[model samples]
Target: MTWKKLDQIRRENPVTDEEEYGQAYAEASLAFELARLVYGLRTQAGLTQTELARRMGTTQSSVARWESGGSLPTIDLLDRLGRAVDVRLELVASHHDPTSSKDSPSCAVAFGAR
Candidate 1:
């Protein structure tokens, strides 16, 4: 493919409406939240992920995965993460009801990944 074609592909696509814009906003917000959590934890410990891993007796790759949410950390790992950041990740229930209940938990209702 030509450089021009590649450049065009790299450019942001236009959003057509409020619905599309809100969807994009939600996805981007989730990504930002994940990144921020990772960064905050590492920085609070006054260490990079590598250094924090060293202190936590784990591999930097492990930390990297958790930070990016590529892999969810275990409860144990989350406790360690909290220690590293001097903050806790608490579990809170949503006020919104699930689309599917135990009797009908088969279908998923989402606008998209967002």
Candidate 2:
């Protein structure tokens, strides 16, 4: 029984079927990124999960779920969150060469405190 670093294991056994796992990976990555963004906004605004949820007209569990990456929020929810935190949300989309190794088109969501 030996210890192995997670990154080492991943490097040794990379995903061979991109067609199967690519979409899931991209979705998970986006969820994680959005979770971090939500958490950051809440903390930066000096609000607790309950407080933020109240401001967003949602429940604290919903905020916790968002922060934990358990669910992906919709644009309408994002807009409400931005309003609650006094930040501006900008969603940008860009196309990339399909022939490239990338799995899909690039999209970014920017949050700026107002």
Candidate 3:
């Protein structure tokens, strides 16, 4: 489905209708984004999931799961992926006060490939 359609559906029947569901949806979206990044980087480097997995000392299935957004890698695995793909993942966390709408907590991930 198109993103617009998905968004319209979300507006009508949001997966995040509740606070807990919202949190879960956010986490899942993050996972999917991470998976897409991994797939893109791997392909850009001309490596198959199996080759990338071998470089990371894991199995192709594990890499597939990561790319499929079915599972998340550990911090250690993330580090390995960064190294293997010659990319850097920098995360910055900014604190926010509950009363300040402009200063809400935020996360920034910078992806730089060397």
Measured by lDDT, the strongest candidate is 2
Looking at model 1, how many pairs of residues clash?
A: 0
lDDT of 2 by residue, 25-106 (tens): 8999999999999999999999999999999999999999999999988888898899999999888776766676554437
For residues 43-84, what per-residue lDDT tens digits would candidate 3 score against the true structure?
999999999999889999999999999999877888788888
Model 3: per-residue Cα lDDT at residue 58? 97
lDDT of 1 at 50: 88
Predicted model with the maximum TM-score: 2
Model 3 TM-score, 2 decimals: 0.69
- In model 3, which regions exceed 4 Å deviation? 1-17, 96-114
Q: Estimate every model's Cα lDDT from 0 to 1.
A: 0.66, 0.88, 0.84
Clashes per model (N, Cα, C within 3 A):
0, 0, 0
**Candidate 2 TM-score, C-alpha based:** 0.75
Residue 92 Cα positional deviation in candidate 3, in Å, after optimal superposition: 2.2
Give the TM-score of each candidate: 0.49, 0.75, 0.69
**Using lDDT as the measure, what is the rank order of every candidate, best first?**
2, 3, 1
Error of 2 at 19 (Å): 1.2
